[model samples]
Target: MTLDDPTRRRAHRAVVVAFLAHGVVSGSWFVRIPDLRDLAGLSDGGLGLVLAALGIGAVVSMPLAGALATRHGSAPAMRWLLPPLLAVLALAAQASAPLTLALGSLAFGAALGAHDIAINAHGVAVEHERGRPVLSGMHAAFSIGTLLGAGVGALAMAADVAPRVHLLAIAAVTALALLAYRHLLPAAVDRHRTAVRAVPPTLGERLAPLRRRWLLACAIAAMASFIAENAVGEWSGVLLRDHRDASPALAAIGFLAFSLAMTVGRLTGDRMVAALGDRRTLLLGGALAGTAWALVALVDDAGVAIAAWVVAGLALANAVPIVFRAAGARRPVGPDGRPAPVPAQALAAVSGLGYAGGLLGPSLIGAVAELLDLPTAMLIPALLAASIALLARSATGGERLPSTAARSRPAANASPTPTA
Candidate 1:
């Protein structure tokens, strides 16, 4: 598609709308969890288990989501998937029993996994058509939505809105956004056009061999970044409250800073990636994130630690998008005559592993904090991010640049001319 093409603009708009809805709703979910806990009369440990259900469900569903996106084009899957997600979101807010919330959380997680894959698959196709960087911008929109969602939910909570009411409002807004943009999603062409054919597989044939070495490497990078980021989300507040004696209200600032920084970073990421290329972008981002963790872990001053945590968000902004771009970058035709490693699969694998680490990060950090201190616990994330930088460096040949021809491609759709 040419830069001036109308269809391309519409496709981009559709993606942005989908992203904004998904982000805001998802962010509000986090903000409302405390209310859910209060309504259920659960303790921190019990609440943790309930939250873990969401992660487990997401991990279980990701592989299936990838397969679904492969068989059905992303647009079709999204139309079917989102309404159910909205229903689950509503159900979660209204659950009366722990068991009910658990079930709702599972459904919510599954929906999220499916939505994540479908949207990314859509993005891969869009980016391919756009020729330049579109993936990062789409992701950036998700962060922006997250920030908005969280703020809205927080405001409602501060105003004494019930969890159900707050969630219902978010759902209404998100559903409206989805409806508004639904028309712009890519229409179903031959699902096989991108590469993978939808033939039934034998019992053993269902599992495709992982041949795209680069994609595997991208997953590894994703694993590192997600693990570190989720750790901060799960543990930073605890550190502030426990070690620094900060009030619960103030402790929340850690995540706010992280989310806000991440949003700004993503919004500007495409420009950076377009100019500097992926390898260097990852290198710089990884270093900044690692440094942020290190400082937050070692510093005693609460203000300093909080500042460091906030800065960490900026460091992390581009890493995930770069990894997504790497995963999504398939040879138009792969060597095996099959569609190359698609973004859906990469996202699934990476998200699954990353969520697992999200669970582990807190547990490990808690153990270390028990033996030494919370600051010492921070060291683990710092080191983990630093190590990820090394892996990314090796994966990308330690700072290779994009080819001149690749750089010169029209800043629009990267697709080949359509057959008449």
Candidate 2:
């Protein structure tokens, strides 16, 4: 109920650490992409294929990860999945050929996807048990971790450290963090156990939430948000450099501004959600992101475009978190009156679609840019953001939890009568 509760405190800390670890490993890998490309002597198309392996792997594993979490609980699933992922990261760092990189990317992506679902499941469960909004702050930790990892990687690059050495260091640190926080994770409980033991539902029944209109809408909204976010991450620098003729150093500023805005927005997201409610937050965020993109599309000034990117990041910061929280909270109840397939399964479905959109968005933008122009191609995410705003209500399922103090207060009219 409160941080004074040890279990709650520990769970919260563990979840944050888990998120940080995921981000650190991912950021470290991302920063070394150019080096990896050079090492493999891959052309742009070859590199694209190698990166695609990662997405393919992630898409395939997301549902399976959800199933594992549902059966064994998030803690055990995370504990079991993280080591392999770390190993894969190390393997990827050592990759010397296109084929090896692609294979490593596939394994790395699978591990990352599974770890993501498990950690998010843990975060949602912790939030529910604590009975207050926390998912946003947890996501903020992830953003911070990413920035930290990227900073570290940049420093390593400046020092001319080998990719293998850098990646090994990241793996070691991540492993240490995992070991340190392992005890704090929520203990695994077999959801199958009951006073009267029940058989697990069939796969069809477990996945029934996928057919629900509300869930489908949430997934679509998540996809739209992801498309916007990934577009900025992947193409903002190019847009500035190629279109605006900004210097290389100046061009990098766009992504930096975007990342900082995202981190700041998420850090303060809980208060906003408490004040505005999920529906309002989603509406405002989507509108803000759409408007920012429109500004970027309409304006030609580099500085103005960078500022727009920052606004876009801030606006889009909480979109995915809101979608995930709603999915976990509103999972369908089974025939036995228990949540079917579990929250993780619903999260996985949403995340899978989002990941697909994220991976496809930049490539789609590139194709459209070739067909039309970069500015016009950029309008696609703006439109997507507007769609998210229009559909915010349906996406969030209208679920709103009261503030902590409100939830903790006893009803005034329900005071207990004096007992003899």
After superposition, candidate 2 runs with Cα above 4 Å error: 1-4, 34-48, 189-207, 237-248, 330-341, 369-376, 399-420
TM-score of each: 0.83, 0.84
- Overall local distance difference test of candidate 1: 0.67
Residue-level lDDT tens digits of model 1 in 212-293? 4554556667767876776666666667777778765666666667778888888888888777777777878788889988
Candidate 2 minimal-lDDT segment of 10 residues: 411-420
Local distance difference test values of all predictions, in order = 0.67, 0.73
Candidate 1 residue-wise lDDT at 294:
88
Over the stretch 163-216, how does candidate 2's per-residue lDDT look in tens digits? 999999899888976764565545442222221114544556444666766667
- Model 1 / residue 399 / CA error / Å: 6.8
- Model 1 Cα displacement at 73 (Å)? 0.8
